[model samples]
Target chain A: MIKQISKPPLAIDDSAVDATLVKRVQGGDVRALGDLYARYSVMVQKAVVRTMPRISDADREDLVHDVFLSLLKLVNKFDRARVFRPWLYGVAIKKTQNFRRKRSVRALLLRQRATNSEDNPVHPPADGQLENAEIMEKGLSSLPAGQKDVLILHAVEGFKGEEIAEILEIEINTVWSRLHRARKTMLQLLENEREEPGGHENGV
Target chain B: MVCKYLYKYLDGRLDWEDRRLFEDHLAHCPACLQQTSDWQQILTVAASLDNKDVGARVAPPSSLDVQRFETMARKRIEHLGRLSFLGRPLAVAIAAAVLLGIAIGVWKNEAPDTPHVAAPAAVSSRVAPHKSDTSGAPSQSLSEAPLVSPSATDVHFDTKVKELTGSETLHASAHNGQCAHMGPDTLCLFPKSRAEVMVSDKAHVVALQSGSAVFYVQPNETREFRVTTPLGTVVVVGTRFSVTVTPEHMLQVVVKKGTVRVEGDNEAAMVQKGAVARIVSEKSGIVTRLATWDELAAFSVLSKMIEEVPAKPLHLKSAKKPVVHDAHQLQDTAQAQSLKMLDTWRKEMIAGDVDGAIEGLLRYLQAHPNDVDARFLLATCHKRKGHPKEALALYQQLAQHQTLSVANRAAYLAGDVCIKQLSNPQCALQYFTPFLDHSGRDAPQRGEALYYKAEALLQLGQKKEATQILESVVHTFGRTGIGQRARNRLREIQP
Candidate 1:
């Protein structure tokens, strides 16, 4: 494993690094695959969590590797004119979507809730935060699929309207409309939870 | 009353008139104003998934997860890569072209990548001047050919050292664009140039297989230093010289100091200091002349190489070996320093304090689980402490290590313990398989892997498999000490 050492701050563009690594990977350079994984894994993992909140840890881990494996075979289709991060995230989202669609009903029903909270690097949903996290998961899952995607890409991933538009491959106006409706529905869900008699909700 | 423009306004998408209407409504409508605050709060909670102010709700993949993903992904790529490369129509055509090229070379009575050693007496006479015999050199044109290893056995160091078989280099990198150090020899490579260096008891060999490199070899009487190009070999006792493979793939040797025997085809040229030797196949024989300014410019990096060995270590060893202390006791004051404590623990091990060493090693591994050397030492401590199972487990973990030598060593040690300590030959086979799987034919542990695998096979009542493996050991590595042992075993088994 290449330990990421703390180094002198250099103004290196990430896009250039990604482009170089992608080209090298397309040429069958394995180290570049490792490098490309190292750079974007954290972002992809976060996206995985937001995309598939209920995915079993083992399944999630497999899903993550599957995304990269798909990239290894499919990256040739990535346009040089497009940015790599959005392209890679697009791959991750599609893999997750496919994983969701293909997994058996019995498997979904038997999905194990993670017991090793200590091992989880994610901030555990605790106290009032637990309700919000649950609500976020429930609310997002309940939304129209397109609206849910736009909301997650905008609010959770912190992508701009333009980047989300490019990633979702939709018009910028469609992204805004979806994001608007998604946020409104989610806000209504949270407000109803807050107003339900027991009202000492944690402020934003 | 619900305001339709509230969310759009938050998104910075509302037009000027719409923004006015939204603010105009919010000015009097407390319900809409409070609703906007609620939306802001909810979005804050949502954004907290990514925001660092509140701990990020979604953690990225852990380092271990990243490692697993990398390993699995690389395996998939490798599997597909092999299939794709072989599956290509172009691959077949290229292979045929290469075969045809080799056939033509053989038809023309030329040997490629084979340098004949010159006896000292005939070294001068046998090498006819410019118009003479050039026998061993490859007659095929290398003008468009990519530089590759001469062969598996006599392979040179290239940038792809990670996957390359054998212990070829101590350290290799294009440091500051030119010079790279391999032990005492400093190789200053021309930009984008390639070379391979191997140091062993018998020979210090370098294949300047492509581009050019200025080699400064410090003289050692015990070993012969030989540099090979695709076209020829330059044997020197001690020398500062530059070897270049030109665009036409001709061998150009410029010697700045000492004498070098340059051999190409069947001809040899004894190039002295300040001389240049050119070997353009047997037809051109060997030409000697004064070095040009450009040929001498290759030595400019020699001044860069003049710096002393670094006074301080630039980085800590990733796998630090425990240092044994002879007399001094480990102080409690220094116990807080885990790595130093590791040294004291090592001293304790040497002093037969097995429990103390185990205790310290366990603690050390708890802190630095990835340190394979420390883990190996801990395994040794465990084995000495008579816990074969514990030691075996640690060695099994160590076998997965990325360092080729360490992985091979771990597998070999694990197999030995399984057979000798635990008397489990089947388990021994399990451990030995990794050594064989990862080791290339030229890999240092390839012989040991085979030898141990054969031993396990024999113990498992698979004499046929054992015999075949033993025969392979004899056939593939018959020159080595392991081969001799394998041959002796074969004799006992057959007779």
Candidate 2:
């Protein structure tokens, strides 16, 4: 007979662990909240950082803080029997959306101000600096705001298109349409870049 | 039932019967298989990019922090309570004063029987001649309150128009201090007003606040009407046009029509009626010239067709293929057989036999280990069976293969298993990184891989590094799904 290695104590069954933590938290055991946070923060932080690329480290930390604060406010509303990870993730996703909307508004205002200043024409980034990544970012940012939101939720956040629709309060078909258009636009832009002499490093 | 099942299947939230049916569909439908491949790729990319640190780092706000917040909240609440006690009488007094002012204003309007109130009522009544013509039954509720006083009602209507129509559309009509939603499709059809109309599949009606009203029509179907705008889009069944109001607010007409005319903005250019012209800057005036085919394609309606059936195999029966080489024939034969096998599996899955589908795929894979499609399907089947370890192993094997395309698919699957099932972002990064190196044109998988790689990095507590990768994804494939995700992620990370 083969001997099996003993499972570690911390290797509690996921379902059981979540149920216990939820029960404790609901019972006003503050430490349970900390435990849950410790368990899920790494994933949430990773998700937030990956979603908000242009945001600085300091800003990322602040957003992470905001997510936690929001989560606390929502702990009481959680369904104890259900897994907390998805619910927590949903909160993180919402916070990220709010941050992006605010950033977009700020960027628009800044652009308007700069345009009015007349000090210098807003020149496009120099050719050399337009890396594949930068080109991709510009193309994405140029998309309609709604399209950008749906595409990001479905593609980056790892949410199903249906999940995205639910979160964004739109139809799933809309998400699909936005994603399709976004891809087509990106392809067109990339192809255009490739056509220019010495424009893109990876020529077609 | 079909939509529900598809949703559940895609979400991996399906039970046994549904899962079996989904697998059968996968086995039989080549088109569905291709779509499945695409969806798998997307999921893989997303998993690779997901923050690994999410579960590990998420801690509820500390007791001390919560206490501090609660204390502050308590103090604020107490302060508000006290303020309310003193504010009641003062608020009542202020309310009485406002009511008196309103009463005076109403008395003034009553004395003159002001033509202002009558003007709106009469104009609305005229615009909607057939009150009983509920032909297009207004889906949205229209407030019945009179718009006589400069009261909240008028303000509310103005705000509603601004919200429903865009700022650009309302600018002209709002300036004339008049804004209204006309017929069902016509939100604000102000005649003789200079309006900027944005016409596309997405429609909007803008009412300009300027003396000259601008009308923007994003017309869906063919409808002819004269619209006055400093800049407007005159759309035909198969054409697009633009009219703009310059900084000087002068109307500039740019015709992007399949067949239309440029009458006002400047010199009348009797375009073939299907050409594009631009009202140049305020200094230059209207430049109504013919547009190129590329420009025409831009305004061409973008319609997507969703097929219920899978994509059929391309029949290779061309005149040039009369005598094919043995090797080429063998390859074609193999492709045909693979397609048939896929179809069989889909039928089985649809019949609600997930295991049978998997068994068939497994047997097929044994003979064709190099078959990326088969391998991917098999891995997915295993995943559906709740066997993440086996699925992960197969995905890993495929990810390490020589072909970049095949490897990318495998890498994506591996990443999906790691992040979604195994909950291991560290493991997912290992799979995602190789795909990112060569994620280029034929491999949209690369954009996806880079996205996942960023997620894995973040999970590992490499915040700065992850942010850099995400930024790169946004910059390189910004318009693509992966790029959008990166941009969204960047926003979430902001302070």
Candidate with maximal TM-score: 1
Best candidate, lDDT: 1
lDDT of 2 by residue, B24-120 (tens): 5454332244445445433332232232212223343433444454444335335545333222211010000000000000000011111211111
Docking class of 2: incorrect
Interface RMSD for each predicted structure = 24.9, 25.6
- The TM-score of predicted model 2 comes to 0.29
lDDT of each residue in A36-126, candidate 2, tens digit only: 5545555566557545554555566677656764544466787765556556767777788789788778878787422223321233543
lDDT score of residue A114 within candidate 2: 20
Q: Candidate 1's error at A53, in angstroms?
A: 3.9
When summed lDDT is taken over every stretch of 10 residues in candidate 2 chain B, the lowest stretch is: B96-105
Please provide, for model 1 over B237-263, each residue's C-alpha lDDT reduced to its tens digit, 9 standing for 90 to 100. Answer: 234455654444366677654445566
Q: Could you say which candidate leads in DockQ?
A: 1
Interface RMSD of 1: 24.9
Weakest lDDT window of 10 consecutive positions for candidate 1 chain A: A3-12
Residue pairs clashing, model 1: B134-B282, B135-B265, B135-B266, B136-B265, B137-B265, B156-B196, B157-B195, B157-B196
Docking class of 1: incorrect
